[model samples]
Target: MATASAVAAPPGEPVAAPAPVPELDLDRYLGTWYQLAAVPQHFNLACARDTRATYALDPQGNISVYNRCTTWANTVNDITGTATINDRETGAQLHVSFPGVPTQDRLDGPTNYIVTALGPDYSWALVTDPSRISGFVLSREPALDAQQWNRIRAAIETAGQNTCSYLTSPTTGGRGDIAPLCST
Candidate 1:
């Protein structure tokens, strides 16, 4: 689990919303992505290993989100959700809603998911919420090289997120060295 609960600005400090990437290619972004690291959330508390998410285009042109992870008991926990574009022009800001998950189903709230940064080749991405409370580090592979990790750290700082808040996720054939992102 992550050491911090939320990443917030200093007391009484006004902070701008986290900006999304200039643009997002939905087609290229749609696929299975390994959850390399993230700010632990209540919903994912049970996840013990092999956390990954898959995105696909539904018939209605919306993005379908399928997330699964292995629990300590060796059971696979799965959840399906939908992602709707919040910024049509950039396609980088989105609102993801999981049917039975209340935390992700806020329809009238600010965009809860923002793709703040992406690798040049779309191989990795940094995501966060408007408040900068929640964040995720996703990659095409379960593990990344040292250089890639450095770049990701820079991106997280650039996005106004606290590197110390991110906790690495464990995965098979990847990294299970769960540690705070800043510790790298």
Candidate 2:
């Protein structure tokens, strides 16, 4: 029952590009999502705790992206961006652009924000770029239990990513032992 995109490569060979979810409902996805874990990125370097993103529909029918985090210096860092659906059929592939952010704006290029996995109730999700360089584990709650962590890890492996690279994000009600996604 494996599709072409789900076919695994032979040992030592590169895996195919990550496949996005079959479909996405914009209304269901437009809400605040707490960062449970993420592949380290320069823009998020200063984030200390409570990293979350809020998405809403904009006037032009694009997704409005609002990301905020408490910095190590105890100040709040907030940024706004926009997301455009590149794959209208599935609505799971998108191009996100942040004005004035270094190297983040790429609305003109191929889709980078791809939702590879999502919880049945839309309570959790796995997001990654086409290159598979950046990844994020997002949830409706600030933290997930052990069972939820295991599910997220399985989804990460299914997407051909290394769980070791995903470091836990600190949140008020999160796990005390913050570590890599594989160890959580």
Candidate 3:
């Protein structure tokens, strides 16, 4: 499970965020983000390949999360979630939640979702938490080339995440196909 590293501070007092982007443009950030790589998580164990996440902004400024992945067992798995900005000033920290589960802040505390890095043209992004326990490499394309991967790897290190912890995720030949295959 992911945990947040928070320094003790008086209630309502200002707190600093770890490895968060200086600013975020939600309009540019919204849309499909393929999961190129990630730190292993129990919930994502079954996701053998083709993991993806789509984001949409609500009128209330909340973000809708649509996550999907292909299992080695040749099945499609998905879940819908929501992310609310934890801090309005930076727009880099967010709190996410799935149905029937407690919010990220409630379950893991604040700073559970942080935009650690972003591509210049919004082609890719790297998200991490203050704890550095969880992270994801997202891209507008279904797959990333070696050069892009290297760039993202550098960004991960810059964001204070462990570069060695990430493993590449497979894809449908960069087609972004969600269909399940019967056999490997």
State which candidate has the highest lDDT.
2
Determine which window of 10 residues in candidate 1 has minimal summed lDDT. Answer: 1-10
Worst 10 residues of 3 by lDDT: 175-184
Count residue pairs with overlapping backbones in model 3: 0
Which candidate has the top score in TM-score? 1
Instruction: In candidate 1, list every pair of residues with a backbone clash.
Output: none
| Model 2 RMSD vs true structure | 3.8
Q: In model 2, which regions exceed 4 Å deviation?
A: 1-15
lDDT of 1 by residue, 15-90 (tens): 6787899999999999999999999998888999899999999988888999999998999999998888989889
Position 28, candidate 2: lDDT? 97
- Could you give the candidate ranking by lDDT, starting with the highest? 2, 1, 3
lDDT score, candidate 2: 0.87
Give a tens-digit lDDT track for model 2, residues 1-184.
1234554678898776688999998899999999989999998999988999999999999999999999989999999999999998999999899988767676555788999999989999999987788999999998787777788888888887888889999898875445887665
Evaluate residue 75 in candidate 3 and report its C-alpha lDDT on the 0 to 100 scale.
Answer: 96
- Candidate 1, residue 149: the lDDT equals 90
Q: Give the TM-score of each candidate.
A: 0.90, 0.90, 0.79
